[model samples]
Target: MMHQMRAETGPDGATDSVVSWHIVRNADLTALCGKTLSTAAPVQDATRWTLDPDRNCHTCGALFLREAPYFPDEHTD
Candidate 1:
């Protein structure tokens, strides 16, 4: 399971960007591993740690990239 979050710039860029958080949980993982599931942490924690840790969104493996303000225009072809 994969949770997808979308961040959209607000109207006129005055307000903060709109962020949507999607939570995806896989309860069948325990059955596959023959273990019990027990945790209180956020689903992101479990996914990043136990699953894909290097696929861009993993907090621990995520590298911060500083983009320039005038990088490029979205309408550029």
Candidate 2:
């Protein structure tokens, strides 16, 4: 699992607004040397949630969508 976090200011003048996403991927083993491999879907740009809805994983060469965009705890340190 991987995590992506973004912070934005809301209309109420709060800069603590944040959006987080959980990225899940699969792992595979190479047949030749038995090396474990993993991949996370690659996005073209920073605005992936809006621009690249469907992207390809650079490592495993699979297709996946970003999911669970939510706010994290404000008190997180």
Candidate 3:
């Protein structure tokens, strides 16, 4: 699964963007699993980890990319 977003501002000065998630199935995983596999929800908090099986056929696996400023800050205490 991939988390994507586009930054935008509303007329009222509300700064926010709609988060979009994308999941692409892997052909190797399909062949291995012998069926179309879907992305399972994260076992733990998303900030900790995500289980995106379609991308990688394993447990507790995820791929994260920081492309834009749409994502929430991870440094806050």
Candidate 4:
């Protein structure tokens, strides 16, 4: 199963741009959307992962659904 996490490209998640959320692979701590995990930001909750449309990175979301085909909180055959 693929693990997930949330991240941003801005410090303390404070950006004046349109994008805010970026999806990350907790296993390797890499972003599927090719975005920087903002490791330089203040300490953050690494477990703040979500698939909410309002905060999801569309690019990462699409890649995630295509690669895993199952939600982390769901059971699949």
Q: State every prediction's TM-score relative to the real structure.
A: 0.19, 0.17, 0.18, 0.54
Put down candidate 4 lDDT per residue, 1-77, tens digits, no spaces. Answer: 44555446443354433355555665444578787665543223323445246866778778876766654455645
Q: After the best TM-score superposition of candidate 3, give how far the Cα of residue 68 lies from its true spot, in angstroms.
A: 6.4
| Candidate 1, 15-47: lDDT as tens digits | 443222122234232212232222321234332
**Alpha-carbon shift of residue 59 in model 1 (angstroms):** 22
Write the residue-wise lDDT of candidate 3 on 16-63 in tens digits: 321222322321223122332222322123333233433332321232
* Weakest lDDT window of 10 consecutive positions for candidate 2: 28-37
- The per-candidate count of clashes, in order, stands at 0, 0, 0, 0
For residues 1-77, write the lDDT of model 2, one tens digit per residue: 43221222234333333222222322222211222222222212222433333332232221223232333443379
Model 2 segments more than 4 A misplaced: 5-22, 25-47, 56-77
lDDT of each: 0.27, 0.27, 0.28, 0.55
At residue 20, give the lDDT of candidate 1.
Answer: 20
RMSD in angstroms, candidate 3?
Answer: 14.6
* Model 1 regions lying over 4 Å from their true place: 1-25, 28-31, 39-42, 45-77
Descending-lDDT candidate ranking:
4, 3, 2, 1
Query: What does the lDDT read for residue 24 in candidate 1?
Result: 25
Report the Cα lDDT for residue 10, model 3. 29
RMSD (Cα, Å) for all candidates, in order, is: 15.2, 15.6, 14.6, 4.8
